[model samples]
Target: MARTGRRPGLGGTRERILAAARSDFGKAGYEGTTIRGIAAQAKVDPALVMHYFESKDGVFRAAMQFPVDPAEFIPRLLAPGLDGLGERLVRFFVETWDSPAGSPFLGLIRSVVGNEDAAAQLREFVTREVLGRLARALELDQPQLRAALVASQLVGLAMLRYVVRVEPVASASTDELAAWLGPTLQRYLTDPRVTKVNRRSRRRR
Candidate 1:
């Protein structure tokens, strides 16, 4: 069955597509994600993705409403090498959340009740841009899994501190918190699993 096209310039439809793009790109990253996938996620015809975004790159650029350009920052961050990547990353994240710019994140989380779209945007962005970049740089055996584990810590911290407003985890100083969390992320980025854990996990999936 043909999917009917919405009227051109339909109110809220473009926003819906953009939000869906954010979610898809965040989850799959630019290379792994697709326009047709985004269209399906948006509940629109694939033509509409091209109509609104022109191309996959266009969709990616627009979908990334990040506070900073992840591409530029990722390079700069990596240039410093892996010695203190975890600490540097955590410090940056905590600083961003503590700044006025962090307001958008809080607002997004606050508004996320029955609204997973915004959550997806946040999740995917961190997953694709931050974790993905860091993982690849490590050249670990299971880089993606490692990065994902690290992302869980960072995202969990964000949710606790900014969203759920959990007491000590929320109020603790960034350096103090980073000191505790950085090493865990470092392990995920560098740890080598001698067992078939990585291969076994793939088979299970």
Candidate 2:
């Protein structure tokens, strides 16, 4: 049933904006999803949509609330002295994307595949949220660059394994993938040589 003691119209404006954004973004993607379309769908003035979210990007961010926030998970993923972080990272992602909660990720992949603008937004989101945070947690000197590198590798894996469903790799068990990928991630995160050039440049100054 409907939520108790609350009319359908209660909390209507915000809910309507979110609902409109979800549909518009899912269908038309980031670039195609316009304030006018959202306002039309929400049955509210365009100004109202802007009032809730300053821009399209803002609406997109609010609409896509992943079940697990990196703010909560990243610290756990990076807890000092945690051995086998690479394995844990792989396992965490595999488990997350395999579960029902990963529907949003799947939807995001589909959106990106179909729309270049949406693909850029997806890249931005991954960079800002996942890779950026991971870099900071690892205390990388160039957090953004490191995070983008990690995101590229992980996003590629997700695309091939889950979205494309490519043959044996796609069918490969999560544990198997983790075993193969964990070491690479470990090297990326811990290898002193990963950013030797950058370190050397800083040292020279």
Candidate 3:
């Protein structure tokens, strides 16, 4: 039986627009790429690009698709009754970074490395799409700080391994690194002493 609604490839103009936008965003950094360029590349109208994505940032976000949404990822990472969560979190990040899903992520990171405009764009994307959203979803206290620490851990490791390709650090297995680094992140994520004052207020609740 044939299902109703738009078929996969025949989803019409919108699919075409996204396909073009992805290529443009990947080849060109967030700033370097434009809606006009995407429309031209996709052989569509500029209006269509705007129609689908709303703006360049929207196009980039859609282009660099993530396997896991932050709403799901953060809560799972911070789930109660899960001890040694730091290691699990590190493992999750390592697996994602090493997977095929991470290619677009790496591309975005490389784009941010040198250029100021690209860096700013990347920062906004990371803070809003990746970190801030996760914090909001998880109800994590001091979301900005937690997100920053999480980013520091993941990004620092990515640089050490993939970018700089440092010695033992680069070659180290994910489990090995997790063993060493999990406690540090665990402390950041859940240490009572770190938020002693805040914890006192929560206790009053």
Candidate 4:
């Protein structure tokens, strides 16, 4: 008699799968990456990947584990109402990135800068998971556009402060950054000017 199939309690298989997934994702993006491809690279059966991670999205989330749980925080942020949301968002962003927990986010931004596929994947993920939720919660007009505007600001801030490490921005304290960016974010979130701009653009079209 012999043991057929993978050995029980084998170590490294999970890590190997994750590594393969990360590489594949970096190269192919989420839509291009496949379970079979990841399993092949990891030298494991597709079933094994499903067994450990459940699905592609699960694997992606595990591979790119964000320090904060969006489910927990998004609600909390919304709970306080829209008042001061801009400052709150800025504070949260800088504080999170300033902490050790921000490593994954930093890595993500770096990956996005060099890889178009990675950038697309990030855009999809942020829009779908983060900004989309915020926009819907606010019940604002032109939610998608509003969300995109917010994302642009935050992403730009992240690039300067963390990835590029630009002077002043990179060296600034979280409170300083929050104060500087808060009003702008607040405007993006609630200002009627956004609606006016949209109307003007529509008239031009």
Worst 10 residues of 4 by lDDT: 1-10
lDDT of 1 by residue, 66-137 (tens): 444566666776788878777877887798789765656555556445556556655666677666776677
Q: Pick the candidate with the highest TM-score.
A: 4
- lDDT of candidate 1? 0.70
Clashes (backbone N, CA, C under 3 Å), per candidate, total: 1, 0, 0, 0
Better-scoring candidate (lDDT), 1 or 2: 2
Q: Kindly list the per-residue Cα lDDT of model 2 for residues 1-205, writing each as its tens digit.
A: 0112223353678778888888887677666789899999999999987877667756666666444566567888888543677777888888888877666777777766887766766666667667877877777566666556556667888888888888776888888988988887776777667766634445453
Model 4, span 1-205: residue lDDT tens = 0111234365878889889998888788778899999999999999999997777866776566545655556778889999999889888888877777677787776677787766776676667678778888989887777778877898899988877789999899878988899888888889877867635444443
Q: For residues 1-205, what per-residue lDDT tens digits would candidate 3 score against the true structure?
A: 0112224353566667667766665566566778889888888789867766566766666654433455456677766534787798888888877877666666767767765655765676678767776567545568678768878988899888888889898888999989978888877766756554544444443
Q: By lDDT, is 1 or 3 better? A: 1
Task: Candidate 2: give its CA RMSD in angstroms.
Answer: 7.3
Clashing pairs in 1: 26-124
Name the candidate that leads on lDDT.
4
TM-score order of candidates, top first: 4, 2, 3, 1
Instruction: Give the whole-model CA lDDT for all candidates, comma-separated.
Output: 0.70, 0.72, 0.69, 0.78
Collision pairs in model 2: none
Q: After best superposition, candidate 4 residue 56: deviation in angstroms?
A: 4.5
TM-score, model 3 to reference: 0.63
Candidate 2 CA-lDDT value: 0.72
